[model samples]
Target: MKLFVNSLSFLLNVSVVALVVGGATGLAIIRDHQERLPSIEPLLDYRPSVRSLVEDSEGSPLLSLGKERRDLVSLDEIPEHLINAFIAAEDKNFWDHEGYDALAITRAAVRNFGAGGVKSGASTITQQLVKNVVLTTERSIERKIQEALLAFEIEKHLSKDEILERYLNEIYLGRGAYGVSRAAEIYFGKSLSDLTLSENAFLAGLPKAPTRYGLDIEQGKGRQSYVLSRMSLENMISEEEYAHALAAPLLISEGDNDTEQDQASHFVRSALTEVESIVEDAGDALAEGYVVRITQDSDLQGALEKSLREALIAYEYRQSAWKGPYKEDLPPVDSWTATPVLMDGDSYFVSINGEPLPLSKDSVKFANRGEFTLAPGMRVLVEKVGDKAKIRQVPDVQGAAVAMDPKTGRVLAMTGSFTQDGQFFNRAMDAHRQPGSLLKPFIYAQALEDGWSPTSPILDTGVAIQSNGQNEVWRPRDHNFSKSGFVTLRSGLEYSRNSVTLRLAEAIGEEKIGNLFEGMGIHKKAEPGLSIALGSQESTLLDLVSAYAALANDGVPKRPVMVESVSSKDGTVVYEPEDFIDEREPFFDEVTLAQIRSMMAGVTEYGTAWRAFEGAGYTVHGKTGTTNQARDTWFIGFTQNLVVGAFVGFDAPEPLGRGESGGSTAAPIVRAFFDQIDETYRISDYQLPDGAKIIEIDPDTGIPFDGGFKEIIRED
Candidate 1:
């Protein structure tokens, strides 16, 4: 018996030694892995990514778009009822536990042991914070060990409130919402403070399995009931509150139910872009939370959108052509007779009882065109509009429009692109297309400042100019290559006489012309060439309108602006419109302004744009521009108060057909835009300056024939 006892003791000692060695190895490995974990220093000053809001001047929300739709909030901002509800649902002993709940873990372990699988995680909110912020949610013994150890470490550094705040802001609540603040908005369309007991319970129940809960609305409500029952059982909420929460209906937002998006996607995009250029640190605007105040007037914006859309659709209708009908026979029509009139795969017809009639292009009207190439088995969308079927396809043609308060330099409305993705490109300010004849007024104004009068005669005959002094010469001529031998300076601009403009550029030194173009910010350091006088220099629509705004503003150039101010989430003004003001001295003198205004008025009244604004009761002053090959057509019209312009053309810079002109295309768009807002917008008339007199001139000869004024035709 003594010998057997000795052998057993020896075996026990050997086993003890082996177990100690194995345990030491495991501890060393775990220590190494723990050391390799990410540092938690970033959480010390965490700033959740918040959606940057674009607001109108009156502090109304216009847009709130971002990558992660988060709205960071402080622990104090969250209500006590919400906090207690989360605690009951997630970890009932949250306030009393030191980084972890021992009793809860024991119970979860017993439950899992009985189920023979991993069923529950008794992770405290502190542990969840470490998991979300500093570590991944990897399901492994090692990861859980690491999470628990990190939880203890985090609790030592951050207070209870800090951990809760970070957890609330960093938790992913599904539906692209990253935190409680945005979750309230996404699920209920309410602010944090505005949430009811029922709303709070619904949000609190989403932390564990947001995606699963989001999939089944009833399942999500069941989770909310569980949270509510737990809250009531824990005495976190009264029975009455729980009853009301259970009774309240779940009102969730249809992801992307952001009303601001529906308000003005195009303008919001423009404002966001402008915000980027102005805001130095992107975090200051989005991550740190800011409200960007833009100069948008909703009424004007609607009008601009309506006018641009209708005009583009109309243009597309005129330009559309049926590539070919579907190869298969079309369905039977009610009244039409179609007895298979096709012979050589040229056409198809519906069967009818009457005569065998062939289908003609004009027999039935095409409601939509210029978008698709009709082919066999094509699924055509047909909508009956009175007696015609109207289909929808985005046309190949694109356009842009802009409206501004000329005096204040505030951009009221802007529609950048007409395509479905209107925000893809800011055609109003970014597209630097050739201004064409719209540039004539500035050149004429420069001439008048240089001792030239309205009657100063310039030869409008053809002129040949050298290109880089090479053998290739540029023969500047009219739109139709039609030339008038000689014309007055006034007539030169009023008619957009390209030949006359080239002659004036030659008369005025090329260096001064270069200065004039560059100084106005039209084109940068333009090459010394007369071609610039013919609108060869590419300028954004906004820059051209701003130049005309100078003419309307009696010389002071007020640069166009979109964002009026930027404020912090706390409503502290960080950026003001005054900071962006480019209040430069008038680029043109009063006399130059008067002469140019007079000439532009003539252009609108009796020139290329005469028919567009013919009977416009109020005074209208503007010019028309049509680029070579009709690639771009523009019309910039303005009163003393407002400046509006638009450009219509293919995005690929192709011809928009032969007959399309600025007066026929873009002028009417601006006219349509003004017509909608005519009741709201009162265009102020241009007044003569002190010591200025009305000078009468013969329309045909540019000679002062009489002192009698024939309409608004006084030129200095």
Candidate 2:
């Protein structure tokens, strides 16, 4: 019996030894395979280049804000208080951890296993950084092993400071902001250096979930209070401190002069758009780190704003009742607004304004905030709403103003209303109304291009042009309901003879006429009809500005561009515009433009636009146009240095209280802008070429029967 038991024990021992050896062999094979495969250490220290679109200097995110999902800034650059707050709220021991906090992870794991489901992840900053930077947030044992390996690898290479910096910056802080600096600006209306402890705590609490903590502007104090409560619960601040901060008014910085003058919005908007393109080209990660420098002249912008405000006020009170040569109705104008633009002709640094009128929607909104009033000289409001503007209501006013450099077509200033607080409907770019006599210059220009001089005879006996398969009898007439049978072309244009314009349009041919306007940057489609010369077609302010600039540039047209260049934060060039040496197509011959310019100069000097020309010490040349019922008024003109256009009218196309001709309502604003300019630059005539000759002819008779005609210039 003893030998039998011993034999059983021996066999059991042998079986155990065999099983142990087999397990050892399998473990050795697994180890060898692991050695052959590349170690997971390389996966840990990942750094993605966060892309940022170019933005204006004011730091307003120019691109669609919520698109790019990064804000990588150095951790040390963030306020220490912010770091402390974040640590207290999230992982108390983010430092001194390899990849995971054992205590927290174990506790979470046990609870999750017992619950038979994956609960919340007990992720430290490093762990979260590993997941975000290296591996996507996915659930699997393989992925977990990969994450753990990567985190350990991260610990091997990057120092704690560099790792933490990457983690903090790459984390989403809500409101389309990626870093502490942007969050500080977006939330507190202050900088990172300026964050108070309370502000830091509020921002620190956001990394866990930005949307829940982000203060909605519409909710006002309620959202703020909720954020403060979260901070207190996280032990970032005492209850008393939380209550105090909640009660504290929003911390609006004193010197946020960035947008106080409306100086940077234009530049910032351009930068953001430019950066967006760069990012699209370079991919998001690389583009986010791009830093752009813009040619924004803030001082010039402020001056423009001030001058526009003063000019609008002066016009409202003084020239409110003025009339033009084409109108019988005089003013006691119901409402009026005007804009003026100043441009550096060489570089395209343009500044412009459309000062607010009392009845505008923007004014009403301002009145609600107690910033604007029904009368002039109202006090300004300077306050901040969280992540948005706390502006007064946009006024009911209908007007727009724009300014640009004639040489490059870069817009200097663009405003829809006189008041920055008023309606933002950029009349200059948005509205595409008929230009009335504004089309006469183009007609005369086309005639010149067709080998006819401004002195050519065009009998202004109302003629109906019927051609192009679409026209009925279209009898074009003069503004004053009178016709001169044999008026010289120069006299007819100076007097804005509409009958003469229609006659010239027929001579030039509608197809050729349409092509002329298109070449000059007019984008609106011209109907195949006689009224095409009477400015019956619609056009934007931008179109008119570019077209006029083409004329000012001796018929050489250049497409408008705002940004000059862009670069990465490391100073690597991302984008630089090819020299302004673009193709210059001839919209009209130099001599033709010269002749038309001379005729328009007459309109300013002794004809319709004299009001804008006479009072100003500098030489100004422009044409005035008034549509029927005074629905639209325009003044398009330029000096030797700048070309600016102004339009004024009601929003609903109502008759803008009688006598609101382009000269009376729009020209005066141009005068105001030029008067401001004469104080700065040397204003002179649009120099006529040497070969151009000025000939006197009869005003009433087309024949050179007597030199009783005005001095009409013919340029060859």
| Winner by lDDT | 1
Best-performing candidate as measured by TM-score? 1
lDDT of 2 at 673: 63
| lDDT score for residue 123 of model 2 | 69
Q: Which stretch of 10 consecutive residues in model 1 shows the poorest summed lDDT?
A: 332-341
Deviating ranges (above 4 Å) for candidate 1: 1-52, 66-264, 287-289, 322-364, 367-392, 420-423, 479-484, 579-584, 679-682, 707-716
Candidate 2, poorest ten consecutive residues by summed lDDT: 346-355
Off by over 4 Å in 2: 1-271, 274-300, 303-395, 421-424, 465-472, 481-484, 582-584, 678-682, 685-691, 696-716
Tens-digit per-residue lDDT, 1-716, candidate 1: 34422332232223221232344454554455556666777677775554557777677776564556677899999988788889989888887876766566556555654665435557788877776556543344355546656676677788889888888887766545677898888777788999999888988987766644643467789999999999999988899988988999988766554433323456665665565555533223532356778899888887897788768867866777543333334432222221322332755322234322333343224422435444434433232333333332345788889888877878898887764231435688778898898887877887877878777777777788884567889875574433446677777787788887887777776788888777777777686567888788888988877777777775655567888887776677666667345556666777667777887888887888988887877667889999898899999988877889999988789888867889988998888888889554546556666534566777555677686333232243
Q: For model 1, which pairs clash? A: 555-586
Clashes of each: 1, 30
- For model 1, the local distance difference test gives 0.69
